[model samples]
Target: MRQTWRWFGPRDLVSIDAVRQAGAEGIVTALHHVPTGTVWSPAEIEQRKREIATMKDGSPSTLTWDVVESLPVSEDIKKQSGDWRAHIAAYKQSLRNLSDAGIGVICYNFMPVLDWTRTDLAWRLPTGGTCMRFDLTDFAAFDIFILERPGADADFPEEVRAAASARLAGMDGARQERLARNVVFGLPGAAESFTLEDVRRHLAEYAPLGADGLRANMAAFLEEVAPLAQELGLRLCCHPDDPPFSLLGLPRIMSTEADYTWLINAVDLPANGITLCSGSLGARPDNDLPGMMKRLGDRVHFLHLRNVRRETAGIPCSFHEAEHLGGGTDMVALVRAALAEEARRRVAGRADASIPFRPDHGQDILDDLGRQAQPGYPSIGRLKGLAELRGIIAAETHAG
Candidate 1:
């Protein structure tokens, strides 16, 4: 596997030098400033590449932009709504631009409204470090009392709904407002922030589509773009839905193995692939990470190797980001599976034999507390994760 790190461009609290120091061989990033539906100009792409290669002090960092974390798939395209066709054209053009610039892999998700929803940005762990967490009750509270989405209570079980209600009732106005802010909070520096009214409006737009309708829209999108990706030698990987289930009554199409199978078979192309995010998918207990890697290895163009411990036993339960090796997925076994898949690819003489992976989310520890970096992307925490993962890979390689 090619070890990469996600660097949120120039404004990221974590710098390129820091990424290099963390021992990452490649950089995974996106032109975050570019709006969702807009084309990523070749000039903009090249400028980013240059920025990644050159440090703040004009020194060569020698790091190449290895993967595009997202060439964003707009909600317009996801719903096949207003100007969706134009967005699709723009998406294809972005792919072409990325390919022309030698960036062959693009990772994007089709999750409507929010990219990855979390109730708490800094949930304290027993180890005295803090990691991002998603509490089911808190999310339900947001759904029921805060955003007040119609029929929101129907989405949860009676017990869950009651718990959410009780939680909401106890909280003061300040806590409620804070929860709302965190729930709708967007990625820092990404063009995804949303106010409460903005979310309500977006939810209204998605109300008519439901789950099946949304899935069909996603399939239609792949049918148009997958072929172009294949021809351009670009591997377009769809990130699995975070938490892998319904949220705010919106359908989560790419959550499970079956969900992936549906889309992959629908498009039926090599370019149409999966970004097997263990942390996101592992939130669901039934998602066998190692098995999925083995079964879907051929189509997995990118990997996000982090872990989460499920707080409860069910589908829509709570989960928090755990250490890379200590979380739900078996890190060592998953690494071995990845290595075996790479060996198989090498034997088949494939061009992209080595899949690029990054330490997805890490706990905020050591020097990270004072730095106030992006929510889940603490520098030292991710460095620790990368080191641990690198150790696993080394052991696996030696044993192989």
Candidate 2:
């Protein structure tokens, strides 16, 4: 695997130098300032390339922008609604610009409304560190009592509804407000965030689509762009829905192995691929990380290696970020599977022989407790995760 780190931009609390110090061979980033539906100019892309190329001290940062963590799939495109055609055209142009600049991979997700949902950004762990968490009762409390999404109570089970009521009752106005913010203010280091009203409006628009409609829209999108991605020599991968379940009564199309299989077969081309994020998929107990890697290895373009411990034994249950190697997913075995995939790809003489992977979310510890960079992207925490993942890769390589 080709080790990479996600950098927000010049404004990121984690600097390019820090990423180099963490031993990342490549940088994963996007043109975040560019609005979702706008086309990216080569000049803007080159400016970012220059930013990642050298530090303020006129020194080489020893990094190259390898993968776009996302080139945002706009709401218009997702719903095939207002300006949907224009957004698709802009997306295609952006792909051309990215490929022209030598980027090989692009990661995107089709989840509606919010990209990811979490009730707590800094949930304290037993080790005295803090990690992000998604509490079922807490999320339900926000969904039903706080955000007040219509018919939200019916979506959850009776026990969850009761627990959520109890949870909401215990909280004061300030706690309720914080929970709302945490859920809405998800996307780490984005230029802007959505207000609660914004979320409500989006939900209202999506209510009529349901699951099958949403999946069809996503398939239509792939049909348009996947072929262009193949022509441009770019690998376009869809990130699995975070938490791998429904939220705010919205449909979750890409959350399981079956969803990914459907997604890869949607366009049925080399550019149509999957971004195998273990932390997101591992939130569901049934997702076999290593097994999926082995079966879907051919179409897996990017990897997010992190884990979460499910608070309960069911779908839509609570989960908290765990250590990269200590969480529910078997990190060692997953790494070995990725290595085996790389070997096969090399043998097949593929261009994307080595998969680019970033150590995903990490618990806040050490100086990270004070630095407080991005919610799940504390510097020292991710560095520790990268070191552990690197060790596993090393052991797997030597053994092979």
Number of clashes in every candidate structure?
0, 0
Report the C-alpha lDDT of model 1 over 1-400, residue by residue, as the tens digit: 9999999998999999899888899999999998989999999999999989987788999899999988888889988899999999999999899999999999999999888889999998888899999999999999998998999989899999999999999999999998998888865568768999989999999999988999889989998899999999999899988879989988898889999888789989999999999999999989999999999999999999999999897888899999999988999989899999999999999999999999998999988988989999999999999999999998878844
TM, every model: 0.98, 0.99
What is the clash tally of candidate 2?
0
Can you write out model 2's per-residue Cα lDDT over 227-321, one digit (the tens) per residue? 99999999999999998999999999999999999998888998999999999999999899999999999999999999899889888889999
Best by TM-score: 2
User: What's model 2's lDDT at 184?
Assistant: 90
Which segments of candidate 2 are over 4 A away from where they belong?
none
Off by over 4 Å in 1: none
Colliding pairs, model 2: none
